[model samples]
Target chain A: MKGFLLTIISALLVILVLNVGYYKEWFQAKPLQYWTDFLKEKDDTLSIEGVMASRYGVAYTMSMRIKQVLEQKHVTNPVILFEPNSYLRDSLHLYPKIRVPEPAVFYYYTGLEGVWINSPDTGKASFLVRISSKGVGLDVIKTPEQRHQLLAFYKKYPPIL
Target chain B: MPFLLFIFLFICYLVAGYGLLTIFKMQLKTAYMITLSLLLGIAVASFVPFLLQLFYIDLNPASIFGSLVLVALVLNIPTWRRIIKEGFPAVRRSFALKPFRILSYEVPYLLIFGFFTFVSIWRCYYLPPTSRDALSGPEAIAEFAVREHTMINSFFNIDLWTTNNQFKSPYLISLQMICKIAGFPFGQVWLSVVFVSFTVFLYHALKERLHPIIAGLLLLLFLMTPEMYAYTFMILYDYSNMIFFFLSLYFLFGYFKSGIRSHFYFAGLLMGIATYIRSETLALAVLFLPAILLSQRRNKDSLAKIVKANAFFFLPSFLGYYLTAQLWIKYYLPIHYDIGGLVNGHLSDWQPLFQRYSDIVTHLMASEFGIHLWGYILYFTAFLFVAEGIFVRRYSRDARNWLYAIFVLYLGVGALGFLLPMMNLNETTKRALFKLLPLAVLYLANNELLIRLSQRISRWEGTPSYLFAREPRPAPTPIAPTPAPAKGKTAPTVAKAAPASASRPSPKKRKK
Candidate 1:
């Protein structure tokens, strides 16, 4: 019986030690941000966003809508991308519009794009989006006809799923 | 949960198998006990490291796996079976049923086999594949082989290449083939299979020659040591080379004992194969040739007879490597260009040979004796045993020869390491040397001390002499009784005299 107890204790201790070591990043690779940034600089126009939504189409639509809102607010950026909801909320302070209730109407700041806004009932923000300068609305339609035509075209094609 | 279940089932299988051996009369109780002890010892050792890892104490996988294999090999089992056949007449005459009964004269081996299997699997799962050497050397070779569909001559402009260069050992190629057949990524399982198989083979081979208890203990020592297990699972050339080297020795010894020349041929073939794995193993081949020649000379064999006997063993062995090397040289240089430069540069390094030797000695002593403190306890114990054997000359000639060979080989390898100026004589090499060193010491020690002690005690007191002298015996009756003159008259004096006279021999008879 004593032997059995000792075995169990030893096994548990091993499990605990392994769990701690894994969390402590003992096996983690060294920092590679510099390499990542160098690679990203090669393709200035392209922006990559990692998302974990259940539906790809929904996530795509949400990203496009956010991009459109930012453009309307005269936020010209090279790239505008939506992060996953879980990760976005985790870093809520880094993004503008604390509580975004609906997918279509995303509450964003006109002035400093990433300013926090609090909703009393709903609590903190739902998502955070990043916008680069290249993606801003530098080119504008002079007349209403151009804008209508652009919206019509977007409605027909829609964003990819 | 699945892993735990696996462990439990494995343990159960081992216990059951050992129990079955007992039921079948195939092994004695001592074998079971020794195997159990080995299993427990390994379990504890493995668990301790694992626990340390959990507490964020990271360790190199090579050290762990190497230690595990060493431990398993050290715990030896000594048991042989005698087969007895029994014919049952109750069955139909036409059937002629004969049941073979196995009478175990020593310890059980099946339990040991089960333990080996479990630990091998455990080591495979926990240890990562060789990421260091494999990522750099073998991977490049493998990729080139896959692209060309044939062996290449040079790697990175260095000649001395072969298509088989991608594989550290032919056994690794076989492992890859198995993974391929299973429709799995060959790289994923290749190293694990090679590592596990090498350890298993070593354990079985060593067990065949040594007593089970000693073998088990020695195996444990080797496995638990930091180097063997660590490298065993790594996709490096060294571990595989060591395996093949030991395997060659194993077959060589078998050939010597049985006079089966074929075993020698296989041993030579393995030695040849080992050269491709690590160029260093070539030294072993060189050493073995002279040893064989010396043995032949010692036996006083004729020159022609010796040549003929050795030819059978050397021909295929030489041809295998020669052909392979020739094919490689056709496309590339005979020697690897970088290797010469590396060797020379290392030779000119700053470290002194004596300093390196002392470092190696220190590490070896610590690993064996100290447990964790001094570590030299193991080395000291082994040294004591070998010394005792040398002095007493009590063990069998074969054991003495094996011990001497081990000592010579250990020193020879150490000398090679020392000669290489840049070679870091660190804890790792010391640990690797410990695998064979401690076992050799134990073998000599156990035979001289344990066996001799038993023999001495047996000799001091003769059997059956003391028991008979201490016990009382009945007196013998008289040979002749004087006739009673009067039947009623006191016949007591005559009867007593007759009995006394009958009991004692006459003086004339006694003198004669």
Candidate 2:
């Protein structure tokens, strides 16, 4: 009876280990599309920007979020490719700059023109963003007209997104 | 390369600590050695670099390596030879079948600990520093050190040193330098190894006093604690403090049993390291001194002898607190506030102070989330200690009873000292209670009522030997009866020494 109990426990342990593996994403080799779709479908519109990904997929969703946000703002003329977003990487690496809400990404959104957006603040709010396009403070988005000019400037960039 | 260096430094620390214990004439228990060595290694890493950095040397891999080499040459190498020649065989023998022959059942508790430990290690790799303190405190301190490649902090741009003076201690910064030297991003794997080793040590400590099964069960209970398991992967120094504080108590208990001066020194040194790990552990020095002195039971000793022993115990602890405060005072910003300020702040405003005290005490009793099961254990243990009084001799000797009493007193008093000054007592209570949790576990595991309850359970479960079971062989010589202290002339009976003072001297003078 004890041996039988031992076998049952061993089986249960194996099952539990496999379940842990599945939840931890250790087993399957899922694509970025799977995650992007999962995030996009998890919530409509703003959820793309809102959803926090696992630490491994932080860069992927970050670049994807920027792509989705630009698509929403009608800045479609430029090709947007985020190359590991050094500004955000460096910001996250910087101890004081990193806060409770996980800093998402600081991307050089290269389109018709390349822009460096330093989004140190990651929260429910979308208004507080630090973006620099063309030159220092050239199309800095402090107000609506500046936001439009920034988008218009990006609208001239080649479509690669 | 960085991973290899971390492993290398870790092994060097283990060897160093093991050798030191052997030199101190400790029994050389592997679990105890592993845990003690890891903590001592961290303290050494922190202190060595700190002294180097004082001379305008940059705190980097080269300096850290140089410090390790100096330590190895000075103390570790000679001690290592003695440890291998004399201690290795004894340690190996402990793992032989002789110890396990008496025990019948190996419960599933170990399996549970293994699962959680595996999960914690996995999470360390998978997760980033997400906890609030981790983001801005020790992890941040390490990042700053690595980025600058120096221990000197030029900018006080962040409020990192207000309540966060604990970070100014070079332990985390030294560790961070090691990690940077190794090439791994700052993760909890190193901390996880330390945490897991601590649990192993806790198990051994308990096993010495209680049934192996009970020890295993209690250890499992401790590991399964929600906050403790989470903090194992979280970059916080509090858990390490918890382990060191518990080890100090373990050594204190060993001293009480054998009356060995080295055991007392070990307790003192571990307490000091605990204080260095977290400033709050400074209270332990104040808490333990009375317990230790009272446990001595030696009234005939000269004043000089008493003072020397007291100095031996407290000097390390004072140094631990000093190492931490000195870093802030000399190099970085001065400590803005401490326990003294808290007392003065509360004293001036009695009404608010009373209100805060009432709220914190009430919350401690009712706290469900942070303190977890340990809170309930504390509540129950306090009740048992009060109700039991000094009427029963659950343990054989009065010194053992006094040691337990002092520890319980320390836990209760230490918990309040941590809570009284806090801005958010509710949020801080869990971590504050962690310092008390190990002591609470010891109390519960050894409580007369709990022992009885467990014996009943063990009988029903068909276990061979119950907790507190007498060995099959005859017991050792009972302590000799001696003159008791006058009533009201002595401190509380819980703080009194053994009945016989002469029995202690032989162990006191014996050299390794």
Candidate 3:
């Protein structure tokens, strides 16, 4: 009985020492960060309107959807800037020149290229989006009037199946 | 908790495996006692260093010398008779004759060998071909070989220590050759094969020399060592060096028993190969060469014969790498050499040596407590065995003195080389010591355990009656028989000794 108690006491003391030592960083566990869970929770309904290079491969699909949304809002003859022979077709062919009209609103999506919204006073409707076989997501930028115009246009067109 | 449980399970399995091997070898009791003693020994040995530290003493010269003296005292104790009387029956029962049936003997070896082989294959097959270290030095050489489509010139240009341009010793290159032959995808597989083969060879070597129980226990202890096991799976030169070191010992023992010149040659060759793998093992060859030369000095053989023997021993190692280097230089770069600057830099830093040594000893003692402690515990146990062996040698004269002498010489040289006043002890020194440790522990434990058993047996059996047979026998008397015997009664009579004394041998030949 005495031996058993001694064994128990010794075991506990060892545990305490280990805990203290570890807590004091005599031994350390490596640092780890997980980002996959955050990416999975983002909203999917937003759409972008921008000129995307077809040569950009999968990055063009989002640009096309944004172009279609602008066209439905009667914003025709918007200057398209995309790389030539690029897989992303909406990109302009000219090199080193991206023309933006006055009062243009810049929309930037730090998360996904396609799922962003922006509005500005510029006459040019400039959008940047990424397209992939995964599907079309959106990023949009517009003034309050432009947004109202886009909502009314969307209500009329309703999203074709 | 799960990790702790896993470690516990692993230890239990090792103990159980050792026990099973002993029972199979018909040495159940020896196995049990050895396992218990070794585990206890490891704990005791690890603590001794710490205890010494309490006195503010340097562990180097003092602890080693003191441990040796302490071992000597422990060996001379007169407790053998009591131990033998109590322990022998249990030993005999444990090693019952049933396990040695011709078919049964092969089963355990085959099973163990096969299991380790599978494990090696699994580990190797899964190795990522391009690790960060691999991309730089040894792997860079391998990569260069693949890209150039030839192994010829890779050796000269590649260096291991500086910017992946270091010249790795030929050992890892040989393994790489195996990987190359198997195709790049199976590169890791060859390391596994090497690990499994080395381990199996070590197991057999120990088993042949000592009791099977001891061999199994040694194997278990080795496998349980986290650092050693981890290296076995990784593409490292240490594993190969460790293999060759054991192989050298195995062949040396074979040479001793058979008086085979070829065995000595093989032993020297293996030692040389081992030295190439790790420069520190080169110290071992210093002891070996002298022992061989001394043993042959009294022989009447011609000088040419001795030269031939030495050549046979040394040529394989010298020529094998020389030829490889020649080819490599001819095809790849002009010349290959180690830039000694990095090593010299280490030598210049003196403060870490004492600190690291202290830290290593402390970690080793605390390792007995749990998961993080495994490697330290194994190392400490080895130190204990060395201590015990040193103690036993005081009484056992016929014990392998030459081997012990070599061990001491190697340890001294290694310590001086690694811990020179100019050279700070670093991770490199620690790693080198770790590699040397397993074999040292095996030798120490085997020697101490055997000595104790022999002493105990001697005490219990009165040193065997045959040892005291030279004394003369008492003279016999003649008796007269009665004229008639009663019905169903037998007469008692004494017979006189014959006068012929020619049948008995002289006392000189029979003297102990």
TM-score of each: 0.45, 0.66, 0.45
Q: What are the per-residue Cα lDDT tens digits for candidate 3 across B425-467?
A: 3334444544454455445433545434433433343333221
Top candidate by TM-score:
2
- The candidate 2 chain B region of ten consecutive residues with least summed lDDT is B471-480
The whole-model lDDT of each prediction reads 0.38, 0.51, 0.40
Provide i-RMS per model in Å.
22.1, 11.0, 20.0
What are the per-residue Cα lDDT tens digits for candidate 2 across B278-325? Answer: 665676567666666666654434567668877888887788787676
Worst 10 residues of 2 chain A by lDDT: A104-113
Scored by DockQ, the top model is 2
User: How do the residues B47-152 of candidate 1 rate in per-residue lDDT, one tens digit apiece?
Assistant: 3223233343333333333433443333212111211222332112212323733212112333333443444444343323333334333444333333333223
In model 2, state the lDDT of residue B417.
44
Docking class of 2: incorrect
Ranking by TM-score: 2, 3, 1
Can you give the lDDT of residue B179 in candidate 2?
A: 60
DockQ of all candidate complexes: 0.02, 0.06, 0.02
Query: Which residue pairs of candidate 2 clash?
Result: A78-A157, A79-A158, A79-A160, A112-A157, B2-B182
lDDT score, candidate 3: 0.40
